[model samples]
Target: MALKPLGFYQRLQQLTLPAQQAFMAALCERQLPNYALYAQTTGCGDTHALKAVLDLVWEQLSVRGASIDFARQAEKLVECEPPADDDSFGARRALDVVVSLFSLLDTLRGEAPEAVLDVSRTSRAGVRAFIELTEGEEDAQRLALLIRDHPLTDDENGFQDAVLDAVSQPLNKALLKDVRRLGKNDGVSNLGLSLE
Candidate 1:
């Protein structure tokens, strides 16, 4: 059976963990090793690890939604240390992954308001903890600064493209191709549902 075109929000909700992970892998420019680490660390057993991360993101969004200061949360994100077992490059580029995730979420904000709010509702602490586990070396910090400085584009495609352009890694580019493919009218059918 083939998956049909549902809107982004609906599609997101309908996707299984492996599918969601593939979506995230494409969206976040993640490679296999790091992707596995994220899955393992975040507990991708019955659920998507990124979904849990989204919940943490929702926590920050909720605070921001209240028209309050969320700088403290941002500060905490930078302070986090990557997990020791994660020699994965994804851990090294954790900041980039996070920025991409937030950018992607922000793009779909209007179309999936309830999911956004609900997903973002989980405590920021979990995401923050994950951020810490990422490699926070100087290069990662510098890239993070670049991401932070760049303005988020108005449209989803534009934002995704801009992020992809900003990070010139082969894996990221490959994954983004999938991301773009998934965003199209009948993109869902193209997804590689099996977990790697």
Candidate 2:
């Protein structure tokens, strides 16, 4: 069965705070290539800075009392945002990656109760945009069903399920490592974009 967005959000909410943070981080990790490709193609954003933020986020999740300057990190992320008027698919995907990381940071800061949900939505929206671009589907209703049933969408849901299952277990450095590997998906993004 296909996983609905609301159902996914509900499952995400059931995870503990650390688990939720890890989930968001894993999703962000999967999307990093989107920004990396955008930066490589257009030289518009800093891929290294975004990677640093995600690294710190993972450190906070895995290491106890790991003090992270999230406010400063958020400021750095703001600088990485793609121009709103770029209107390219690459820029849109890059923006989605940044937004997902920002939501993760907001969750870490206790500043947004729905930050996790926002990450979930943003990730799925990125996939949807990818489908729309490649498939050339113009009918709204048909595209909605097409997105719901797409193989990439299935991969996204399956990836999230795997991350949740790994995180729901006892939290530890090893588990976080495993989750990060899972998110890497052999360096492919949820939409199948890769740096290499």
Maximum-lDDT candidate: 2
Pairs with backbone N, CA or C atoms under 3 Å apart (clashes), candidate 1: 58-120, 59-120, 80-132, 81-132, 81-133, 82-132, 82-133, 82-134, 83-133, 91-135
Per-residue lDDT for 122 in model 2?
Answer: 90
Task: Give Cα-based local distance difference scores for all models.
Answer: 0.37, 0.90
For residue 146, what is the lDDT in candidate 2? Answer: 95
Candidate 2 clashes between residue pairs 3 or more apart in a chain or in different chains = none
lDDT value, candidate 2, whole model: 0.90
Tens-place lDDT digits, model 2, residues 112-146: 77887888889888998899999989899999999
How close is each model in CA RMSD to the real structure?
Answer: 16.0, 3.3
Q: After superposition, how far is residue 27 of candidate 2 from its true place, in Å?
A: 0.2
Residue 128 lDDT in model 1? Answer: 32
True-vs-predicted CA distance for residue 30, candidate 2, Å: 0.2
Best by TM-score: 2
Q: What is candidate 2's TM-score against the reference?
A: 0.93
Q: Each model's TM-score?
A: 0.26, 0.93
How far off is residue 166 in model 2, in Å?
1.3
lDDT score of residue 15 within candidate 2: 84
- Candidate 1 least-lDDT 10 residues: 185-194
